[model samples]
Target: MNHTIQNLEASFQDVKSENSVLKDKIYSLNSSFYQYNFTYSDSFQRQKQFDELQLLQQQQDYMIESMNHTFQNLEASFRDVQSANGVLNGRLDSLNSSFLQQNHSSVDYITKELQLQTQNLSLSLMELNKSRSEDIETLRNIIRSREQDVPKNITSVVNSLKLNDRYLSLSLLDLQNNISMIGTLLQEQQRIQSNQHKLLQMEIQNLTYSFNKSTILLSNLQTRQETTVAFTAGVCNIPGDNKVFSPGQTVIFRQIIYQVGGGYNPSSGIFTAPKTGLYVIFCTNVAEYHETFWTKIMINGSAKAGVMALLRSSNVYIYQSASNLVVHLLQMGDRVWIQVRSGNHLCSDSPETTFSVVMINGSF
Candidate 1:
């Protein structure tokens, strides 16, 4: 409302300024008449009246021009704002796409890198034992060299081989440690990537919420401006009179709520729906434009619009199967209720007015 008023004020100011300018222009364009034999008082009064008429004419022209200009400006600005909003939304979508693509690529690359690392670690272990055949041959040579031919340096030679073996063992241990470190690093990276993905998702969700809120705000503002057609549900003075009905799904009333099946008890004025399905129950009172309490289906105790009803062409049968009972069930605690929708506003003077429910075999 405030925004609408502000725009109107701005438009009015522009028109006023334009009107003043047009008046000045018209005055400048007009020629001053000089009469040789005219009396001063009468002639001056006639000239003043002519000038006033011209000024009024100019004011009219100014108003028309200003209205056109203001409308054009407003239209252009609205278009620009819409364009900007679209671009922002597009960019946000692109960011989401980029994030998903990036994560996918990262995962692929990480998998490849891990595979390569594993291969290299295995190769390193293989290389470490490549000289096993030569080591075995050297030991055999040492054994055949005999006790008699053995020099005093033989002990030293054996000690040297044992030292080499110890060195080889330490090297192998170091290589294994390197492989383990690489595995740990890769695992750490995966964890970090997962956390990043989660953060991105949270940010996207927040952005979506903000975008929706802003869009709704803009729409509401626009709606409040320009034009609006109001919808007012007519009132009926049923002080305490109310209603209920059930097939749990389908209930139809021409004028009065029959409360058919297990839940519809016109006498008690209470409806109980046992199962789930479309229920079309309506009320007739001294009201206009607000009729039909057409609730198609009640799942458990909630109303479902029957998204598949159109496809399935499926509907339920509602009738008073028992004594003042509609399916012996209660249709209560469901969403999509119009205060004007619960069939009727029960008159406080009436006995008890409520809807009931029970389980029944029906498809919707």
Candidate 2:
């Protein structure tokens, strides 16, 4: 039993190992599934980010181009104003000479206004250049930050996958251990059943030995009682030829032949016990050629012993006989008889087919 248990444990371990390997394969498949999804999703998100970045970069470039165009337009407008002021100054100088003191006050006021307008335009150009430089610097900083964030996000995703893989491996190991434990429990159950069967066999052997001892003691007691016992004997004789019978039908004999006691009843084909005792019952079964028949010794509608006969259908008209002898304990009033269990044409051509019962021992 110990060896069997060990072998079972070894087999269970092997199975556990195989299951562990399968779990590893399953984990690998799951990891692959997760990886595929992550890759697809990350790639999609990265593509979207890249598209957004590209759009931002394009917008920045367009803004820069628009600023450059505005600066050029501003420079052209300043140049046109300078040329117009020079021509106007030349005309004012000619008018002042021609009108003398009368136009001198008006020329001075007009010159001052032109100088103020030129200073305001110069200040606006300087402010526009500064704003453009600041915008360019801000765009550069944004590009640098986005480049740094991409690597950080990728690393985080990879770490999460590794963590998931570890968890799956641990769970698989636990399941494998659980299966191994269940296998051990099953082995214990089988060992228990085996032990129970052995115990049952030992008990049966003890009962049989006790029964045989009691039977021998009873027989010895009957032997001592034999001097005071009355004798009882009965015999049946069959003389018909080619008698057909069906299954479960009693085999009746017309002649009691030699019954010394009132136990035998010819009409009912049965014998009732006059006293409780061990009795030896015997039967001789005869069958026709090429026919098979089954005969059973019955007690109160239940068969106790049986015999089967088969005869070879040869040209010589061969007859066959099967016999059975059984010893049974019967109580007073219990009936014993013989019946045909199976056959078609069963008969007795002579007095060879017979049934008999004799008391072998008296009740103890």
Candidate 3:
């Protein structure tokens, strides 16, 4: 029994010791957990504050940089504006000086010139007045002598001759009415003269054109001995081919194409000279009544020109047409064209409108 009790006591003491050790370990764990939680919370708060402060500093730096950039640009712009203003001011000063100088010089020059002219005019007027006074005095004396010595009987004879002579005088009696009439007549005469001059100029121009054209044609004919080309145009049939034409209805053979040939109709047509000077081309168109058909003497295509018997008043009613033009301005070996124009005309007693031409000789 004693041994059993002793063993039980020892076991009881070991169980108590283990309970104490476990309680101490639990207290140390609780304290460590509390300290760790406090440290973490404080650190978190400090980090948040630092981050906010850093963000604020960054924004401030960005703002400062933008303001600095804006200041630089503004300063450069201000400098440019200042330079431009200075230049403008210089130009304005120069212009003002130039204008002032020019204005003064012009005014002085004009004043001097006007004064000189006034003096010359005054001198001239004085001389003119003196001469007029002398002439009036002499006339007065003559009149007084004539009145004293006149024979009344001869005055009538003198007056008769002078009566018609008064019509030629350049004098005016009525200032208002006659002046208006004279002005109107002058304007009318001026207008008539202007129109006449214009017409004369036009006529001269037309003659000149014709002369130039003729001269050129003659030159071409003489110089260009060889012909270049030729072509055919067409033929015309007017009125009725076989029947007589009615009044106002004349038959026409128009646009006949003719080619260059070696010679004329050796038997039927004769190429004649029309003027004294150089002429070119040998061409003719026919003019006839329905009873007889007109025949054209053709050359090379459409350029022959000259005078013919068709322009007479008696041949006015004769039917005539434009034939192809024949220009024979070429060397001996050269070619030309023969073309016919339109063929038709108003039927009348004499309605001939034919064109013909020929070259007589070379140039002067």
Query: Against the correct fold, how does model 3 do in TM-score?
Result: 0.17
What's the residue-level lDDT of 170 in candidate 3?
34
**Residue range 296-342, candidate 2, lDDT tens digits:** 99987888888888654555466666889878888889889888888
> Given candidate 3, what's the lDDT at residue 265?
29
For residues 269-362, write the lDDT of model 1, one tens digit per residue. Answer: 3344434454443322221122223223333445433211111112532211111222222224322221222332222222122223333323
TM-scores of all candidate predictions against the true structure: 0.20, 0.34, 0.17
Which lDDT tens digits does candidate 3 get at residues 1-364? 2232244344334433533443354345335434433443334433443354345445434534544453454345435445544654565566566657787777676557556655664454445444434543443454344333332322432343344334424333445668899899999999999999999999999999999999999988765443322222222344433324332222232433343422222122223222232334433344444322333334332333422224345445654433444444333423222322332322233323332334444342
lDDT over C-alpha atoms for residue 63 of model 2: 45
lDDT of each: 0.41, 0.64, 0.42
Task: Find the candidate with the highest TM-score and give its number.
Answer: 2
Q: How displaced is residue 47 in candidate 2, in Å?
A: 99
Where is model 1 more than 4 Å wrong at Cα?
A: 1-161, 228-364
